[model samples]
Target: MTLIGENGHAADTLTGSGFDFGEEPNPYGAAGFPLDRRYSHSLYHDADAEPHTGTGSMENLGFGAQFPGHPPFRASESFGIAHPEPFIPEIPQAVPDSQARLSVGSVYRPSLGARGLPDLVPDPNYVQASTYVQRAHLYSLRCAAEEKCLASTAYAAETTDYDVRVLLRFPQRVKNQGTADFLPSQPRHSWQWHSCHQRYHSMAEFSHYDLLDVTSGRRVAEGHKASFCLEDTTCDFGHLKRYACTAHTQGLSPGCYDTYNADIDCQWIDITDVPPGNYILKVQVNPKYLVLESDFTNNVVRCHIHYTGRFVSASNCRISQS
Candidate 1:
């Protein structure tokens, strides 16, 4: 008996009697097809139908029934039908929100003989003095995401060489801060000497402070080091006390501030020679932009200062838009 497929193509010629279509297991639908779950039986023969001369086998007829639009199947040739690759939807990853907000807290001139001040050993090339202006700096950082901000320094030694560098194995990314807008027109090489030096000594990262002449817009003196310490008061000024070096090895936690006391070394800009005049004390955090932040605009604070040849004072100190 000759059987025609649903597509009106001669599917197979059967030569057997009492062939039971209902009892035969469906090989094409054993795993199931992409188009439908039910198998097609359009090419199957009735159990009571008489047999006829056939050139193809039942396996060959099964292909045409499995896929209606597919080409005809042959008994002698090996079947190698191509199928469309499986569909896989792509998923997007979430980005982290890391913000490092730095601001200047207070600006003042310590007594000529403050205990915590560093001794100025006079150098023939440079004039030194005992009087300087100290500014309390604050760093308020937060990681809104679930990940923690982590970083470390590692030292590696080879047979003939050695190297030391900061490593950001976790989410924390920190770097040395500088004067972001101290001298905009001047080349970095010309201003490199004024950069904080104490940061180079410690394996940890630090921020920088600058005393800028608001009138001339020139940086007169700058603090060489801004320590990352714990504050007795919160960033929001809930209490008032002092900051001390505490977490020397770990990064600042999210929603926290690393406050450095104004009495710390390199916390003052020598004003012994600076003429008495109005000035702006600018403090910036993460000035190098080595670490990623959600917002950079809030990294600076400015304080207006009134100076006399005999005494110096700061007023109107607040977070600046610039």
Candidate 2:
């Protein structure tokens, strides 16, 4: 027996050699009738064999007992039926650090995908490693090659014993480089930095923390306070371009009016002509005595500092004439 598919090719074929001559009646009784009763004596019987011996008829063309073998199921070595899901790389946490003189270290570069196959999935684990800005670049465009940048971490410091850790998150494409619009319009860029500037104990003073530069190893700015657009007029309301401040607040202990508090001040000093290098940021806080509280005998002086900011980058050092 032979069966042809819709494409006019032999789909299945069966011959006398493929069937067993000594087989019993069909157990399923197909075609709405019992096999033994339907064919009666017409069904072949093995006369030269044992009494129980029975056989199938070769006279029927469409009733062959065997079916053709199926082709082997094979899979592709590369992307098979369902194309392989794109491979998304993880963003490394250990990026370069910041430096003094307002210049930050360059961002750690990420690895690329296969030469032909590109990664297409959006990274699920994304974080703002650090928030940094350059100082020299902030004040004067002066020497384009010798400008400073600053950066801060996302975590804030509540007590004196806390080091904020920020993760770096880079844009798919840089501002002035290859594949201009490759990155999404709204990339995962913005991050928050912890800030604290208040009176400690009975002193009416403020406190601050500093972010060091990656290349110069100098303090870039204190905490996250270095990046902002605050007041304009100073003294007699004079205009000041770049400035950093520490917020001052007064504290009270109920019952007795607390009149004393300590002040905090975090400062930044810019440096010039520094070699680029990767660095880490560590915070140090020192308490200063201010107004005396009601209980003057016991001086309440304690400084709190926190390290924040992710990896930062400065303009490339190579000077190019416009």
Best by lDDT: 1
TM-score, candidate number 1: 0.35
- lDDT per residue for candidate 2 within 234-277, as digits (tens), equals 21123222211222221221111111111111122122222234
Writing each residue's lDDT as its tens digit, candidate 1 over 146-186 gives 01111111111331112211110001112212111111112
Q: Point to the candidate with the largest TM-score.
A: 1
Off by over 4 Å in 1: 1-205, 226-248
Note the Cα lDDT for every prediction shown. Answer: 0.31, 0.21
Q: How high is each candidate's TM-score?
A: 0.35, 0.17
Q: What C-alpha lDDT, on a 0 to 100 scale, does residue 33 get in candidate 2?
A: 18
